[model samples]
Target: MLNTFSLVGINMGGLKISLLGSLMCIAVLPACVGLKPSVEEQVNARIEAYWQAMIQKDYEKAHGFLSPGFRLKVDKFVYRNRFAGKTSYKAAAVDGLSCEEERCQAAMILEYTVHGVPPYGFEFNRTEERKELWVNVEGEWWLLPKK
Candidate 1:
């Protein structure tokens, strides 16, 4: 036989667990319910995620972040060829960004390794600043290909 107690027909142990769960929910729900990421933050996150996919050589994942028009024009093969293995992106940080007219320009500092440089033909580390254009596509931000 199990040792059990109840209050108001609720098992004591189950009630305690339920109370803890309810309290945890009350404590956590506010943080998730009302706090929405600003456009800048969302776009910045997208930019960072894109670069992370690039760093991992996951071109397909990276391509999914591009605008529909861009994707329609540039297939996965072309996208892969355009960006694959040109440089190894070690890290990328969106240090500067601005949003206007439903579009965003993200200026990021990229730490990358380049291979086959002139003369030495050896790999080198370069930190470069680049800006990417992102556009709103059906309420989600997407990368726009430069024409």
Candidate 2:
């Protein structure tokens, strides 16, 4: 039987086939490209923000970036008491900072002179310092204790 709903030179059977193919292509289009931001980019931004804040000694700013459990583990007062007052020893530079998924760690090289009295006198020294490890939880990151 000949159908009246034919497309151009093609018969009805071919027209139905072409329509189905077009529909399938449209359905699969979204899977071919991404619309959301990449996880790696998000993680890297978090790491940079944390690093900058720490270097600036903006403890509150840095603390705001931490995960909830970590924030509770040590309050603002404790953080200030532990790190705020101490003067920087100087000659320290961040050697490396890397992050993988929810975890990050950094290394620093410190160069200074050890001051001594009497026998030892003052001497120059250089050493590599390692910062504590950090972890992310529920989209927030925090520094873990050194072991």
**RMSD per prediction, one decimal?**
15.9, 22.3
Cα displacement (angstroms), candidate 1, residue 112, comes to: 1.2
- Ten-residue region with minimum lDDT total, candidate 1: 1-10
How does candidate 2 fare on TM-score?
0.47
Candidate 2 local lDDT, residue 51: 46
Backbone clashes in model 1, listed as residue pairs? none
TM-score (C-alpha) between model 1 and the true structure: 0.71
lDDT score for residue 16 of model 1: 26
Residue 126 displacement (Å), model 2:
7.5
Residues 22-94 of candidate 1 have per-residue lDDT tens digits of 3453466433367765676567557756876877778999999999999999988898987565666666655
- Which residue pairs in candidate 2 collide? none
The residue-level lDDT of candidate 1 at 107 comes to 70
Per-residue lDDT over 1-147 for candidate 2, one digit per residue giving the tens place of the 0 to 100 score: 011111111122212322342244345533225544344334334544554565466777767766667678877677655555442222333345666777766454443334443585654443446565667776655666542
| Alpha carbon lDDT at 112, candidate 1 | 71
lDDT of 1: 0.66
RMSD of 1: 15.9
